[model samples]
Target: MTPAGRATGAGRVFPPLPQHPDPQAPFATSWWGNAWIGALEGTSLDAGRLARGRAYAREGHVDTITVAPGRIVAYVHGSRPRPYRAEIRMRTLTPEDWDNFLDAVATEPAHIAALLDKDMPHALVDAAERAGVQLLPGPGDLVPSCTCPDHGRPCKHAAALTYQTARLLDADPFVLLLLRGGDEQALLDELAQRNAHQAAREQSATTPGATGESLPGTLARDALATDYRPPLPAPLPPPAHPGEPPLLPSLPGAPNPTSLEFLATDTANRAHAYLTTGTAPFPTADPWHDAVRLAASHPGLTGRRSFSRQFAELARSVDHTPTDLSRAAAAWRQGGEEGLSVLESPWDPPAGPFDRARGALITADLPRMTIHHNHLTNASGSLQLRYGRDGRWYPYRSEPGRDDWWPEGEADADPVGAVTGMIGS
Candidate 1:
């Protein structure tokens, strides 16, 4: 069924939409109050984000739209996009014009209703059709539901959007044309022509060029013409980046399995081997399986988080009394796999606060984990590692409170030798 048309008074000025208050608000009335309402129908259906909605958007889920013929479609979010069988023939209006119309309505509701009951405009219908507003072809109510705290098909956010869009429709009326398909300027021009024709009929027998006005004369009066000027190009600034560990040299006291030149050379050799022999030089696990296993081993490293070089300071602060403890401390100062390996693997059940046999690596349940040559400690500290999915490696830390294993005295000791002895023991 066709909806009633809205009328615009000749010479009435259409005001702009309201300004948005918070720039960061996820959903704002102003943002959703745009002319292209149907474009938003399928945007909320991002599968990746919706799959992990709880951990991702915190609680908000998405809604889908139902498309139909010759009517503006309704959209709401939930498990899936559903159709609201009931049809609402709609029109859009600018917020400013809408407010003015509402004020006039409040002053005289009967007059507004009478005009709404009048014949609908062809321009509006054509524009609305072009905008892709259509009756959704479906059987049931299209309720948007989210797995988030909001249980209904449409949350407060979507509902607010719906109500606000409706209110915008009650104003300037051309916004409805904009919603239907045409831009604001286009609709306004059409309406302006209609007004001009009516005025011409009312004042018949007028000759052309009676006013002798031209477009350029009007353009001369425009604010843009008065303010027009070219801008100067600014100077380019030097690139600056954050403080990071030196990749090539590594750091003083850091682990170095081999020189970078050697490692790069080895990687190049491996690539050549793969290219020539058609065999993988390095053992590559399935990314998904590797990520799952890596996650299980650490259990805590879920998101894109990193750790800094605070462990170095902690190591420097420890005091040594006994000779064995002194040796462990010196080994720790050396900062590498050899130093940390001297610190015994932290047992699943640690013996003391400073267990001679248990360290961070042992407690973190690191299994068959390859320590990079640059890792600060192999046994007890954080590991800057990567997941299978991400492009780069990040830092992972052991759970706090349980501390034992690497001692100040064992820092300088041969941890690999100690581990070998343990294998024998």
Candidate 2:
């Protein structure tokens, strides 16, 4: 796709950009950076103001920027005696858009690799757009506001801030996610959630079942070109969710419509769950864990009634309490047995990880915390963490009026965020 401002039909420009004074490096060097600049120049009606803004940015008029969810703020100096507070606001993506974006990004492992290398590949952007996420700004996506006296859409100061922010976007793609309503760790946590079942799914796919059917594979080159699903105008599998069996008329002295609806909804949900993972929802090797897994899969009471009775019977046989089953089942729902281990077990970890985690917590400006053995607890003992064997921190809340800790939420790859997220919740 062409950058907004540079698109001249047939790839011809009436007048080309001037030669750069520095051939080795130029302002807005990255394609995304150039795209940002394109958005700015494409939408602005005053070319002279944009030129002045570029000059101001080059002359170091912009201050350090603080980027938040949907805004970037900085101080830009012009001919005026006092610096003006400049802001460039972009529309923050909604949760649905973010979900689609992350789904697209996760589909291609190379996309995350590209981000790690500080490169935003066009293919990743294309993938996101295909998923209905518009990553780069279009003509009106950027709304520049400034505290300056000038009445232009974007005064020179605001434009300066925009240019600097583009450089920032060029340097790190996470900055763009921030502008679009996602933070790095939050996005990572969510991506982790989506991938929580990924391994089990992959294993389930490759491992044959009772029938021992071989799972066939196809090359992309062959798959993309065939009509009979060989290379492929492939069959659309099944409908995304289970369709209702023929609408049944209720008979007297039989089940009511409400009961039938409940059964139908439960059946559809189970099928949807299966379709979602392409397998059962997170199976495990341990029988107890598998039982807990089954319980978690049935969500509402109507669906869970049978599982609840089974769990009660099993809990009695195992000499475990109902509360214990509830807690473990919650963990199983979050990710699987790994999540359960994070909750129920703790082992000694090397100090190296502890020290690194301590630094991150400090950076997050969390309440003062002290690490003890494999746990990190705040001074007041209200919030806490337990280091898992898997090198992730799991959040726990203090049992009110008691001296014990119980797991609260999913394990976080980021130690600081694990506890910080609890605070927000």
Largest TM-score belongs to which candidate? 2
* lDDT top scorer: 2
Clashes of 1: 45
Candidate 2 lDDT, 49-119, residue by residue in tens: 99888777777778656676666666575665335657777887776788788788876778877877888
> Which parts of model 1 are misplaced by more than 4 Å?
1-151, 160-176, 180-182, 205-370, 373-383, 386-425
State the lDDT of candidate 1 residue by residue for 1-425, as single tens digits: 01112332111112222433343543223322332233333434443432332221223221222221112222222332221111223233444443333333323334333334532333433333344433111212223332235543334334433333333444435344433333434333444454555556555557654564443645545747666587878854422321111123225887651233233434555566566566875454533222222222221121112211221222233332233333333333333333323232322222232232235336544323443332232344422221111111122233333432222211213333333333333
Question: TM-score for all predictions?
Answer: 0.24, 0.44
| lDDT for position 312 in model 1 | 26
Superposed on all Cα atoms, the candidates' RMSDs to the truth, in angstroms, are: 21.3, 22.6
